[model samples]
Target: MKILVTGANGFLGRNLVEQLRNQGYDELLLCDRNTSESELEQFSQEAEFVYHLAGVNRPKKETEFIKGNTEFTEKLLHLLNENPNNPAVMFASSVQAELSNPYGESKKKAESFVQAYGEKNQTPVAIYRFPNLFGKWCKPNYNSVIATFCHNIARDIPVQVNNTETELTVAYIDDVVKELISLLEKSSFNETSVLYEITPTYKVKLGELVNLINTFKESRNDLSVPQLNQNLTKKMYSTYLSYLPEDDFSYDLTMHVDDRGSFTEFIRTPDRGQLSVNISKPGIVKGNHWHHTKNEKFLVVSGQGVIRFRKIGSDNIIEYFVSERKLEVVDIPVGYTHNIENLGESNMVTLMWVNEPFDSQHPDTYYTEV
Candidate 1:
């Protein structure tokens, strides 16, 4: 099917067009500002589906809003009328259309033209009144506060929140794209004028949104990442990473080094515990201590080592020789004193996962010989 996407270089249009291509739709006639009026006329004649996404969101003059939005929409729908295909339309309206502002007024007018065209042609018209949209490729400091926050917060740039309690509704770009594509399966339209809402929209306070995004940067140092299982946090986290400056993509991981090689904390979780990398010098013995409640799993990633364990009042010593040559994990159980000795000529690297983050106040650790 031939599809025509207006504002093809725009944030929503680019995302929607790319997803359509990914789903095996290649006959897409993308019309941007640079595309000639004749090209759009030709595309309008052939397109079976139309994504009316072009609009003047922020204009210097209020009149430009009408010309870019309402007037342009009328011209395209008129061209669509000259064709016999009667292409269905998915109009990208904003929730702002509910307001009395000039931009909103223009969008509301454009929605009417789209509704009339759909009725005249007997085709489905999907008027999506989207809330603030945010994801990759959205211009920072333009329309989306989430995009601005993610971009600025990722770079340590200051973000001002006049009212911390101000709540805003936002929709992820991927979610919007998926929902628009799913409309293709919808063949029935009970009426000509229908308002469509994007499902799974998220609500976030200004302060909370900033705080959550800040944790993404702090995760590198504290290793305390956001709860990604939560859909909103997961989506915001992905959007935050995409706006990171190319040169600042990588950050330094703090490493604690002494005579016994170096130890670096990789990741930490509230309920799942922490992962750390331990490097031991040749002949170095580490972890001559046992935890009362914190259990751990140790896997040797390099060199050779022997992890020895002894129960607190038992004389029996259990030992497991490990090396990178063969992969295996040795679980350190509670109430047992354990130690790992680097028995190789080179440094031994061990990856460790503990059941909890380290607490200096209530460190369940007690030094003992194993």
Candidate 2:
């Protein structure tokens, strides 16, 4: 089906477009200030539905919010009214619109326009009020609390949080997109206008949300530096933890700390690939075995370690000292024996990206005397 999506480049809009495309809707017209009027007109002519998502979401001044949100909706409605077909339109409102704040007020005004248009005209309109949205493709700015926490943790920085145990609901981007697609595909709402609230059913505590983010960071073998600033105002603290950029890395293996001093590994499997392990704690050592069909690759995420390797035909030993701020990608040929030991006080973590899936059978692993 032909569809038009505004604010196409924005975080949620981008995800919605992807989901639509994946569902076999490719005849999409994307409209934003970035597109020309001619482009919009062309899109309007071709689309059977329009997902109205464009607006001035964050205004430095209060008046701009009215213009960006309310006025923009009016302009789009006028265009739709002028068209012969008057295709169905879905308006993306926000939970804030029903509550307080200039941003919410503006959205409510836009929503009113959409509701009135749907009642007066032949076209159908669906309004979806969204809550906090998170996941990949999240932008760095514009008040994203989840992104902020993820960014701080990735950088090993402490995530500041308010002491309040207030409940916050979040909607994963993928799920939101899926719901939008389902609404578009179903004809049940055609007989009348519809308004729906979208959010994950479960509510998470503010502190628990921060901890979940920290867990994900640590699981990925990433560094976390947490700082608690008790002196800042609550509002300032909230704003500070809402727009952090994510860290992207390529690695072959990830080491995570478990209940005790023991470590768990997230190893990426690749045939004939090399894996590197960086030891953060002195005297800690890793695997002392060789794989038959499992080739591996490794790089140190942080700290220092020593790699020892041996071959069946050779009696000689080879060792390499890996240090922080250094990246070493190693390739272990099949049946090659190796082990790693840490040489520092801090715990070592490694980033790993692999091409194969894990398998327990025909393990392709054999141990040798150290």
Candidate 3:
């Protein structure tokens, strides 16, 4: 099906268009400010679906809002009228439309026009009043506070929060695209107004948002991953990584080196657990310790090793020979003293996962021979 997307170069429009292409919709007529009127007229005649996303949010003059938002919308609707297909159109309106400000007024006017035209001509239309939208490609300092904070914090730049307690409702760009795509499956309008709300919005306070961004910045040194169980934190963390400077993508971790080998912590989460990489040189033995409450899983990723475990205060010793050739994982039970010894001619690498993040102050580990 032929689809026409306005504001094709814009933040939201760019994301939606790329996803549509990824989904195998190639017959797309993308119209931006540079596209000529005649081209838009031609696209309007052939398009089976229309995504009306073009609008002016930060205009120098008030009249530009009407011209960009209302006038452009009217022009698109009129052009769609000339075609016999009566394509399903989706308008990217804003939550600001509920207010009386200049930008809001223009968006509200455009929304009203779309709704009335859909009712009068029996055309299917979907109208969305979006809150602050954030994700990759959104212009920092111009559109979304989340984008601005993510970009600035990733770059070690300063960010200011005017009110710490100010709450913001935010919508991710992916969620918005998914919601718009879902509308295409409907056969007819179920509601009288043809207005629809985007689902799964995230609410965050200004100060808390700043704190989360800061933690993301410090994650490298702490080797901590932000808790992903929370929906907002997961979305925000993804957005944060996208804004990281290209040359500054990778961070260095200090490896503890000794005569035996090297140990490095990769990731730590407050509630989830910690992941580490352990390297044992040939003829070297490491990790002669027992944990009272913390449990661990060790996977031999490279070379060969023998993991020996002994129950505390017991005479029995259990041994598990592991090698990268077989790719096996050994579970280290709590209250058992364990040691991993390199059994091959080369260094052995093991990936370790624990149940809790390690604390220096109160490490649950006790040094004991296996």
Candidate 4:
């Protein structure tokens, strides 16, 4: 399927693109400010679906918001109108778009533009109003609470709770992407407007979230005993002081490094995508064979390694010398013989993004050169 994605580099955009690509949609048109009008038009002609995510979010001024959110969206809708065969369009409208904030106001205006365009063209517009979204690629300094909490906890600092009683809903990035793709493939929108509230299955209290951070911190520090404090005000104050760091705490949490040079990590699903672990000792290789059905993307997470890959029926041998200084992602296509070895003093970790789920029985994998 030919698909176009805006804000392709942003957090949500990246996740969505990855999902689309994994589903075998390779003819993807990724657009952003860096993308030109010519490029957009070229893709618009070929794409069967357009996922509009590019816009100004959390602008400092109202004018900035109007230009980023409203004007930009109108421009894209105009582009869609010009296309003779209008492809299905999915607009990423924020829950804030329906609420009252400079960001929300701008998004609301953009939503109106989408609705008007859809009605005029007699096309179906799928609008997803997302609540607070948090996952990988999320930066700490942003308004996202998950990033803030992760940042504070990674540095052994306490998180601040603005509203103790307020409950917020969070949907994992995978779930959100799945829902979007489902809607796109289904294309069952009968009405002019198809709105869905995107959120996690459950809601979490703000104060309780803070406590969870503290619990995680304690577990990480290997603290066996729990500190008991009766005074609510004093407890909050103490937690805040104990966890706050000395330096710039607002830095991107994803890039935060420990003494060992490990950044904050995320859980990986083997079937869904790739996850890499470091091999401390040399000569350690995870897979020495080839998977017939598994297509994988491998990137050195840290240290150095020597990767050897050869496809069957080819006498040629290819080798890559990878290091921490050079961030190179090697795509291990299906039915290829490959092996990797750590070549540095430090451990070698590689993140692997796979196209399909891991299966042991019908692994579609075969050993070569034993």
Instruction: Tell me the TM-score of each prediction against the true structure.
Output: 0.92, 0.61, 0.96, 0.58
54-158, model 4: which lDDT tens digit per residue? 877766767998898888888888888877767778888887876788888888888888888778877777888887776666667676886677677767566
- lDDT for each residue of candidate 3 in 1-370, tens digit (9 for 90 to 100): 8899999999999999999998888999999999999999999999988899999999999999999999999999999988888888899999999999999999999998898778777878888899988888998889788989999999889999889999999988899888776666656445566788877898899999999999999999898888888888988999999999999999898899998889999998888799999999998998899998999999999999899999999989999999999997799999899999998999999999999988899899999988
Relative to the true structure, candidate 3 reaches a TM of 0.96
Q: In model 1, which regions exceed 4 Å deviation?
A: 187-193, 343-346
Q: Could you give me the TM-score of model 1 versus the true structure?
A: 0.92
lDDT, residue 201, candidate 4 = 42
Against the true structure, what is every candidate's RMSD? 2.2, 12.2, 1.5, 16.1
Q: State the lDDT of candidate 2 residue by residue for 180-293, as single tens digits.
A: 777676473556546876644346678877766554555344322223232112222233344333245544444455422344344322342223333346667776888676
* Poorest stretch of ten by lDDT in candidate 4: 223-232
**Each candidate: what lDDT?**
0.92, 0.69, 0.91, 0.70
Best by TM-score: 3
Worst 10 residues of 1 by lDDT: 184-193
Of the candidates numbered 1 and 2, which has the greater lDDT value? 1
Q: Please count the clashing residue pairs in each candidate, in the order shown.
A: 0, 25, 0, 8
Candidate 3, residue 167: lDDT: 98
Ranking by lDDT: 1, 3, 4, 2
Model 1 lDDT per residue over 208-270, tens place: 999999889888778887887899999999999999999988878889999889999998899
User: Where does candidate 4 stray beyond 4 Å?
Assistant: 187-192, 199-201, 221-370
